[model samples]
Target: MEEFNINSVQVILWKTMENLIEDDFKKFKNHLKVMKDVPLSKLEKADRDDTVELIVQTYTEEFAGKTVVNILKQMNLNQMANDLQEKVLKIELQPMLEKQKAFEDARRAYEQREEQIKTQAKYAEKQINKGYKKFDQALQDEVAAKIAALREEEEQKSQMMKEKIEKMNREISALSDTMRAIEEKMRSDDVTPPQF
Candidate 1:
C-alpha cells in the first residue's frame, strides 16, 4: 500500500465533515414544518436568532471535542486527532450545527402532536360507535313494542268477530224453530182453504 500524506488525510476528513454537516442542516430545515405547536411563519422568522441559541445549548464543547477526536482516531491520525480535539471548541462550529439542532427539536415536537391527535381521533370514533349502538338498540326496542301492541289489537278484533258470528247463528236457529211451529199450527187448523 502507498504511504498516505497527513495533509491529504486532513483535507479528506474536512470534506467529509462538511458534507455530513450540510446533509444534517438540510434535514433539520425540512423538519421545521413538523413543529405543529409553533407556527411555520413564526419559526421561519425566529430561526435566524433562535438557531444560534439552540446550537449553543445542544452542541456543547465536550460533545464536539469528543466527536472530532473519535473521527480522527477512526482514520488512524492519532497525533492530529489529539491536536484537533484541543483546538475544536464548540463555538467555532456553532454556525454549522445550529440549524441541525433546531430542526431536531421541531421534528420531535411535531411527532408528539401527531401522536396526540391520532389518539384523540381514535377516542372520538369509539364514542361515536358507542352512541350509534345505543341508538340502534333503542330503535329496535321501540319497533318491537309497536309490533306487540298491533298483534294484541288484532287478537282483540278476532275475538269480537267470533262473538258476533255466534250471536248471529243463535238468532237464525230461533227464527227457524218459530217458522216450523207456525207451519204446524196452520196444518192442524185447515178447515177450509182461504182464497188469496
Candidate 2:
C-alpha cells in the first residue's frame, strides 16, 4: 500500500488506542498497577509500538503475553484486530513496515548523493589547482623569457655604446695629430722666412 495509507492506518490505530484508554480505563482498572497514575492523554500521543506494548502488557498475564491484535480487539477494532490475528500477525502493519523500509532506502540514497557531491567537489578542486599551477608556470616562463630578452637588448646596447665611444676616441686622436702637424709646419715656415 501507499505510504499515506499506512500513515492513515497508524492514525486510526492511535485514535483507537486513545478511545480505549479514555472510555475503558475502568474495565482494565485491576490491570492498571504500573500505569495507574499515567495519563490517558499521554497514550493519545503514543507513536511507537513500545508505548502500546506498555499499555497491553499492563493487562496481559505476565506483562509480556499479549499480541498487538489482542490489544486492538480489546479496543473494539474488530476488523483490523481480526486481520492482524491471522497466521501473519503483522499483516495489518505491512504497509507501515514498507513505509519504514522506503524511508530507510531514501535515507541511504541521500547519503550516497551527499558523498558523490563531496567527491565531485574534491575532484573539481584538484582540477582547478592543476589548471592554476599550469597557468602560474606559464606566466613564470613568459616573464623569464621577457626578462632574458630585455637583458640581451641591454647587453647589445652596452656593446654599441662602447663601440661608439671607441670610434669617437680614435677620431679625436687623429684630429690632435693633424693639429700638431699644422703647428710644426707653421714653426718650420717661420724659421725659413719664405717669400710669398
Candidate 3:
C-alpha cells in the first residue's frame, strides 16, 4: 500500500491539519472518502488488505489527541533546521571563496613581479654585454691606430736619415774634386809647393 497518494494530493491540506481531521466521525468519513478515491486500478489485488489497514490507522491516529500534531510540529522544525544548515554552509563558503580569490590574486601578482624582475635582469645583462663589446672594440681600434702611427713615424725617420747621408756624401765628393784640381794647377806651374 502507498503511505501517501499522489492522486489525492492537496497543496492546501499540508497547511492545516484541521482540514484532514475535525471530529471523530468526520475524520472517519474523510478517511473512507480518500480510500474510495484511491485508484484500485494502480494497486495489485494483493495490496488491498494492507491499504485498508493503513487508511484505518491514519484516521484513528489523526482524530485522536496530541501525537499527530506533535509529529507535524516536529516536521516543521526539521525543515527549519535544514534551512539553517544550508544558510550556514553558504555563509561559510562565501568567505572561503573570497580567501581563495585573494590567494589567487596574490599568486598572480607575485608571478608578474617575478617576470618583471627576470626581464630587468635580462636587459641589464644584455646592456653589460653590449658595453663590454663596445669597450673591447674601442680598445682594439686604439691599439691599431697607435701601431699605424708608430710605423708611419718610423718610415719618415728612415727617409730623413737616407737624405742626410746622401747630402754628406755629395759634400765630401766636391771637396775631393777641388783638391785634385788645385794639385794639377800647382804641378803645371812647376812652382814650389808653398808650406801652408
Candidate 4:
C-alpha cells in the first residue's frame, strides 16, 4: 500500500482545529485524551498544530485522519468535516503526485542537457585539434627554412675562402720571379766591377 503524506493531512486537521472557540478547543483536547492518555498538563499547553502533531504521533497518518474526522462529526462540525473529508483525498495525493511529476520533468531536462554538452564538446575538440595541427605544421616550415638559409650562408663563406687562397698564391709567385731577376743583376754587376 502506498504511504500517503502525513503532513498535508496534519495541516488540514490543524486548519479545522483553528475554527474552534476556546470551549470547543478544550472539548477537542479532552476528546483526544479519551483516544490516548497523556498528561493533561501537556494537552493544556499545546496549540492547534501541536494538537494535530500529537494525534498523528499517537496514531499513524491514516488512523489520525479518520480519528480527527470522527471527532469533528461528534462535535457537531459535520459541514466542516464534510468539507475537510473531500479535501483529505486531494491534499494527500496532490502534493506527492506533483512532486513525482516535477522529479520526472527534471530528469528529462537533465538528460537533454547532458546530450547537448556531449555534442558541443565533440565539435569543439575537432576544431581545436585542427588548429593545433596547423600550428605544428607552421613551426616545421619555419625551422626548415632557417636551416636551409644557414647552410647557404656557410657555402658562400667556403667559396669566398677559396678565392682568397688563389689570390695569395699569385702574389707569392710574382715575388719569387722578382727575387730571381735581382740575383742575376747582382752577379752581372760583380763581374763588371771597373770604376764606380
Which number leads on TM-score? Answer: 2
Candidate 3 accuracy as TM-score: 0.41
Q: Model 3: per-residue lDDT, tens digit, 1-196?
A: 2232321222112223333234532443344444453344433331323433343344432222122233333445445334334443444355578789999999999999999999999999999999999999999999999999999999999899889988888887888677767777888988666554
Error of 2 at 115 (Å): 1.1
Estimate, for each residue in 87-125, the C-alpha lDDT of model 1 and write its tens digit: 453334554477788998899999999999999999999
**Candidate 4 TM-score over all chains jointly:** 0.44
Backbone clash pairs for candidate 3 read none
Model 4: per-residue lDDT, tens digit, 1-196? Answer: 3455655777778888888888988888888877665466677789888888888776666667778778888888788778888888676678678999999999999999999999999999999999999999999999989988988988898888888887888777787677666667877776542332
**TM-score, per-candidate, Cα-based:** 0.45, 0.48, 0.41, 0.44
How many backbone overlaps does candidate 3 show? 0
RMSD of 1: 18.2
Which residue pairs in model 1 clash with each other? Answer: none
Candidates in order: C-alpha RMSD to true structure: 18.2, 11.9, 15.3, 11.0
Q: Global CA lDDT of candidate 3, please?
A: 0.53
Question: Tens digit of lDDT per residue, candidate 2, span 1-196?
Answer: 1222333334444544455544454433323333454356555454445454555434431222234445455656577656544523253456668889999999999999999999999999999999999999999999999999999999999999999999999898998787777777988777543343
Q: What is the RMSD, in Å, between candidate 4 and the native fold over all Cα?
A: 11.0
> In lDDT terms, how accurate is model 1?
0.57
What is the lDDT for 136 in model 4? 90
Better of 1 and 3 by lDDT: 1
User: Which candidate has the highest lDDT of all?
Assistant: 4
